[model samples]
Target chain A: MTVDFNAIPLSQLSIGSSCRIGEIGLNGLLRRRIQDLGITPGTTVECLRRGPSGDPTAYVVRGTTIALRKEDAYQINVFPI
Target chain B: MSITTEKDFLQELNKEAETIRLSYVTKLGDRIIADIYKNAEQISKNVILNDTNKKNWTLKLDNYLTSKIFGYPFMLLVLGIILWITISGANLPSDMLATALFSLQEILSRGFLDLGAPAWLHGILVFGVFHSVAWVVSVMLPPMAIFFPLFTLLEDLGYLPRVAFNLDNLFKKAKTCGKQSLTMCMGFGCNAAGVVACRIIDSPRERLIAVLTNNFVPCNGRFPILIAIGTIFGVGALTGQLQALAVAGIITGVILIGVFVTFAVSWILSRSILKGEASSMVLELPPYRRPKIASVVYRSIIDRTIFVLKRAVSVAAPAGAIIWIVANTYIGEISILNHLAGWLNPFAQAIGMDGYILLAFILGLPANEIVFPILIMSYISSGTMIELESLAELRLLFIDHGWTWLTAVNVMLFTLLHWPCGTTLLTTHKETGSKKWTLAAFIIPTTVAFTVCFILTQTVRLLGLG
Candidate 1:
């Protein structure tokens, strides 16, 4: 697990940085949805860009861009790589 | 018990069961998903060589397209360019089509008369049905043919998911899914297709919200009307290329209004009858690929353009005949259309449109492409007997009927916000499979259209602009 002292919420990860997902705190639907899209523990996600309105930030996971809102991304714990 | 109360009871029961089932799914998903990926990765490792050195250009392009500063401007520019092309390209073909079809109509009428067809038959079939249907075909076919292909190309190129990413925040604020934006893009082609596209949304509540609010965006049927009005009222003084560009911008602004209203309406629904927490949004931005020219052309032209055209033509045929009957049949020297218009005038005028305009909208319920033609026919048969071709002439006709800028503005707004066409309503019913939701779909937009137009017209009239 990457859930050592370096863990932080995925939403706080800076743009252009990469991270490995430590733990997902979301329950039910969101957890299933994230996992369904290949976002599992130890998966690498690179922060790409934030949208114009800046609520949902896009990240590259498994070579695909997936957008996550702050509230949702806050539930995902990651370690900066 | 009442249906809604029964539904509430059912939902309450389902909530308990749903939580348990979902918990099981989540528990099962963790290990199951991990294993599947592990197996896939192992297989790929054994059988396939990984390409690590992908070119940076696609990545750089994605950054430019989705970056905070560049995202909106690029989206706007792309939309502007597409609309610019649709506007400029559609005009010449539409005029050519109009000329060709009207000539066909003349020949048809001549043959019908030579066959010694009754005057009423000639009137009903030739002047009535053929005229309006021709109007619909001429006006509708070109813009759709041009717009759908371009939209399909962008969609094929996978830019639409970026659009959803770009607008996800605004939609989230409305408590709806980001995928609603993608469906709204489909609505630009046709609302019926838009309703079907709502299936992309996983949550039932959000999907219904999307289907209901999809009509808020102007479809291809309403684009010409907006372009015409925007040209006349917005950039009336501008000439040539400048006029087209200004009209394109004006249209983009009007569509923006629709987007805002979508947020407002979606928010209202989520808070009210369709209340629920926003569902999981996992939008996949697939790597942009080169859109195949042959497939894009085939799908856009055949699947979208022809599909929508068939719906419009089938509806317009009967509607054109009904229009003829109503225009011809009179009580006390007033045609039924005029009577209906006059009856509707007080209410329509309250919302800044007049009798004939409102009547045309009602008749246009079947297919929106025929609304302007119906309005023109009503005006021409009631007032004069001139054949109108160009938007300039259409503007003169509206002005001739005492149309102010307020009327033009309200007409465009009403077109943007009115009820979906009949086929779309039927589609909503089929999709939702509930009469209540379909009825809700109809009532929500219609109510919004009236309220918004009423408020605007009253404010403008108070300002003495009318």
Candidate 2:
């Protein structure tokens, strides 16, 4: 089944969860930077930590730390670990 | 349904597919995997995806930056505009700061005299150390203030990622990470910051490549010396509109050299130290947004300019005082600075610079911005140097010190390629978590600087330009 990510809270997602990155649903550079960090379809990512503001979150994928805004993080679809 | 048998067969097939995927990932081949994943999904969905001929905006943007036709010229033009803004805006404030700071020097000198201090003490404290610090502050502050902000605005504007996107193919071909270009952008603000930015690359090998190549981007601290010399020698050659344009051309040429060395060093490191296949990168092109002007100014001025200035000042003030004392204090017949400069002269000449300039670079390694101040201190304290505050006066000072075209070219080259600052060194150590790589960072640029300058100076002298 195609996973629907809109139902889940982005902040609640755990670290190391494999997910499909979706296209940006909002306007901003930080949004697309998240996608550029390999949050695309079938690309598995591991969430690292919440940044200081707790909106633009940090994650590890392909061994890089990529920070994402909270609004942008929701566009990503993930299946729980 | 023979559940156990069916499940076992499915697991076996899945494991085989997994092995193939793992192999591709190890090869850093993201595109093939992406294609596979996309095709597999299409097959499973039972959809006829014949309409997939359309290219997306993201793909189109990537092609523009990475296109062989547009890439190099685009890079140069963008870099030129940034340099023009930095140079033009820096002029007024640099003059103002020098005037104010030198005026304070006069006040301090009078105060020292009024306190009944001896002439030698007054000379050492006021004329020697204070004047040097003032010169450093006045010259360093404006360029940094202007340059770092423009750079940060670009960063905040999300233009940097596109730059990385454009340069990624080159880096990948060199067996380095695409993100190395991003780190190079950071190096414009400071090499240490660039080193710290290397964390975005996942592979240890590629990260090391990024670290070693970071010094090729001339940092904010090094800008003052390069600009001064470029203006003096390059522009001084011509009069009228031609002079201004020539000076701009010289600065641009020097920057292009730094970038060329960055690519060369990255290529060398990848082939020798960290041999591997090129990685396929999937970068997203963010929609362009209107830059928040206030935020850019606030963050750039406060976050970058003030922060960097504070750090430079903290380290530079003491170094300024020490250089002053060195230049003024006599040992037997020669002052300490003269002796040191004399000692360094042969080696400096071999690299197309004099001992005093080389000494300034060595001392200024702590902060690239301080080289001008150190150089000024050496001259002012050693000889009967003028205490004027204008760029006009500053130009006279360089002319007085026997600065030739060769000296200017060497200074620009050295500024463009040298060891990263102390902060960058420490940051590289932290990011790479390896002392070996950090040492490589220092050695690569210092060696390159010496070789390039040696060739340049010799060539110039051979042609009788020197």
Question: What is the TM-score of chain A, computed separately for every candidate?
Answer: 0.94, 0.60
Model 1 per-residue lDDT tens digits across residues B1-466: 9999999999999999999887787768787888998998788779876444442655777778988789889998998889988888888898999989888887998999899999999988977888988888888888888899999999998899999988888888888999999999999998998999999998899999999999998998899789878987889888878888898999999988998899999999999998998877888877778789999999999998998888888888888888989998999988888889999999998999998999999889988999988888888886645666777888888899999988988999899999999989999999999999999989998999999999999998899877
Report the Cα lDDT for residue B252, model 1.
Answer: 91
Could you say which candidate leads in DockQ?
Answer: 1
Fnat of candidates, each listed: 0.80, 0.00
TM-score of chain B of 1: 0.92
Best by lDDT: 1
Q: Report fnat, model 1.
A: 0.80
- Off-target runs (Cα >4 Å) in candidate 1 are A1-3, B1-29, B46-55
Worst 10 residues of 1 chain B by lDDT: B49-58
**Candidate 2: residue pairs that collide:** A21-A39, B192-B424
